[model samples]
Target: MSKTVTVEVGLGDRAYDILIGSGLIARAGETISARLPGTRVAIVTDENVAASHLEALKSGLESGGVAVAATIALPAGEKTKGFAFLQEVVDAVLGARLERRDAVVALGGGVIGDLAGFAAGIVRRGMDFVQIPTSLLAQVDSSVGGKTGINSARGKNLIGVFHQPKLVLADSGVLDTLPIREFRAGYAELAKYGLIDRPDFFAWLEKNWREVFEGGDARIEAIAEACRAKADVVARDEFETGDRALLNLGHTFGHALEAATAYDGARLVHGEGVAIGMVLAHRFSARLNLASPDDAVRVEAHLKAVGLPTRIADIPGEMPGADKLLDYITQDKKVSRGALTFILTRGIGQSFIAKDVPSSEVLAFLRDSLG
Candidate 1:
């Protein structure tokens, strides 16, 4: 039997539990039914995940005596988080006659979690939802936060809401089915926690990452640690009014890179983009004399060793110039009153929000980075 780790996100009445283990998906229905008895559920998933784990989820729900009101499987990929599919999910849930008290089950990775959570938030003015996040990325990062939304042509996650889930089941067993690239991508988010504040955790990962990949107690520990770190931050700042923003250590530049690639999974996945972005953030900080250049080199080396892209040139195909990339950065949600707010680091585990960053300085950095 695999070990089960539960991390709680404390938001008083809005609090929920994240269950991380090997077989949680097979047990998801019991967990949900216990917390939300007699509620019908609508399972929202992407085609890729549906092909692999949807039946297990349905069987689990049935075994737990929970009625599944509907199952909607949309096309998979980052592009799925958009206005069009958001409406499709909302329409599917409402069309199935799921009430406000019934639940929407997000049964995939970060994209499904965000899209379905958004649907649950809006359908009939808010319905309860459960996140059965199948991917390591969703299991560790996106599943814990209440933030949900789709991307826009302007920027990523520009249109979203704060909608917490009732419970999250992160099944490590499902990761066995993930492609190597996808799993590596998710590892970037897991490593980000260590970069943000837990230097010890980062060092631990550097030593035990192979064990983490091999799957065992180490993987569970890494996921639980990441979830615990995020849960603590979410408990303190649910709305990202302050400390929660630190969770987005690599996201600012990462999102811009996603936009530059038009969110193409072939060119760059979210985690890969984040890996590059994190290296950029550290390098940029060093350029500002806020951190040692060695810190940037160390960060880059770690991510590259993990097989993540750590530089702008690592992206495939032709990309727009630094100016065009900066245009997308201007549209990032982190912009506050026309000034950029970035999570800059003084060292490997010393990140802080740098507010009102000069656009001219950012432009110069981009130019240098692109060269």
Candidate 2:
């Protein structure tokens, strides 16, 4: 048995544990049953995840005496995080006659986690939620955050609620089944933790990212560390009211890019967009004299070394114009009262919130970036 590392998100009465390790899916029943006694559940997953992991999860829950009232498998991809899928999950969970005390288990990547969590939040005014995050991105980031929502036609994650999960199960073994591209996409998020405020973690990743990718202790440590970083921030700002917005390090521009591509996975997954956006964030900071150009270079180099796209130009397919991208940025959830708000950095581990940034400056930067 691979060792499991536990990180706690201390939210007082709403506190929860994130368990990271291997074979967690098989042992999930014992854990869930222990934490949420006599709870029935509805499993929400995508078709791809269902084919690969749904049965093992079902068996685990069954063995623990947890009843699965229904299993919902939706289409796979970024597009699945929408109203239609949210409705499908809610309808099924309700159709199963699941009461508020029952649980909703999300059994896929970030999309499923978000969609299922949103369903869990609104159905019967919120049911107990469990996150079984199969993708590296989901395991480290989305699964730990209580922020749940579907993407809007206007912006990413614009429609949702802050419904934290009762438990999170991150089984590294399932990552062996992920494509190299998908794995690389997830690594971008892992690196973001370092860039946010853990320069030492960033440096360690620079020296040991290959081993982290190879799997084993390195990957587990990295995941646990990322979760810990996020847990600390979440505990401090559960509603993203203050320091918590720092968590959106690259998301402002990253989400704009995602919206620009219409959330197309072929052109850009969330992590890849984030990869490019992080580099851009550093470069934009340097452009504003907030950080050194060397910082941008270093960030771009590390991300590129991990096989992530560090430039918007690297995205395949035609991209929208700078004006369109800026328009999308204006619509981002981070924008406060029509004033531009961004998480700009001064260098590694020196991020701060910058509000009232002029739209013209951003427009000029986007034009330069698009060129």
Candidate 3:
């Protein structure tokens, strides 16, 4: 029953709140039932999470007198975010006879949240969606923004929509079950908010990331701060038309690496790819004379200290060639009609969108980075 910090994503009528605290899952029924009023819910989760936390969630909702009309658990991991599983979830929601007002509850990590949210967005033309994010990454990043979708074979998150959730319950206590690697992967995204604009938060993380990793007050504070940063950006640009694109700071290179790896969690998870991609972005900015090399070094040092993979060389197993990697980059969602767009930096906490960057320069950087 620790104090829950609530961050509001203010989108007028479509706005929602992200509640972060311990024991929120056990109390989820009270909150969700209060918000949606007599609505039934369909719980969409993965096999892994269903084993770990599904019963508790069901018990919580049932205790609050909310009926769980159906439960659909899919196989876990990044591959589950595709047409096949999306169809399964859609079918399950329809099979459950859920109405438009009923909620589609995502009770797992980023994979489950994205898949379930997308299902909620499209089923019966968008039903109410609730997110009970279990992973540190999903709690702080994916669970907050309404960017819901599955991955395309072409690229990560290429096939998604702007479907905001009605409410997001982020129980940090649940993160205790996550493997150390998964937690670290999520930290990459938390650190990203600092790198994007909050030099103070970045410096704070540099000094206190150890405590943040150990969990407790430091962890909650970090999650709340990251949520606040994202809430502000998302509130202002829900569709990523301008400043919102900054949220994808390292995603261009990161998503390319993901596509290169074919979205395999073993080789490179999303956040690890983001860690390496952030380093690459800083280094590439320095190469373009847009930022100082010292900035890139500092970013790399912090990421490496935290056990994140900060370089392409850190990825395990065989990697695609630079040409293939370049092709993947070109296919990134940031690319505008064959022109390159990247989030470059002038220094720490000073990221900006650089559009129409030369593809030739990017190709050269990829070649050197491969070496």
Q: Residue 164: error of model 1 in Å?
A: 0.3
Each prediction's TM-score against the native?
A: 0.97, 0.96, 0.97
Residue 255 lDDT in model 3? 90
Q: How big is the RMSD of model 2?
A: 1.4
TM-score, model 2 to reference = 0.96
Whole-model lDDT, candidate 1? Answer: 0.92
lDDT measured at residue 22 in model 1 versus the true structure, 0 to 100: 93
Per-candidate clashes come to 0, 0, 0
- The reply for model 1, stretches above 4 Å from the true place, is none
CA shift at 101, candidate 3, in angstroms? 1.6
Q: Model 2, range 231-304, lDDT digits (tens) per residue?
A: 99999999988999898889889999988888778889989999999999899999999999999999999999
Clashing pairs in 2: none
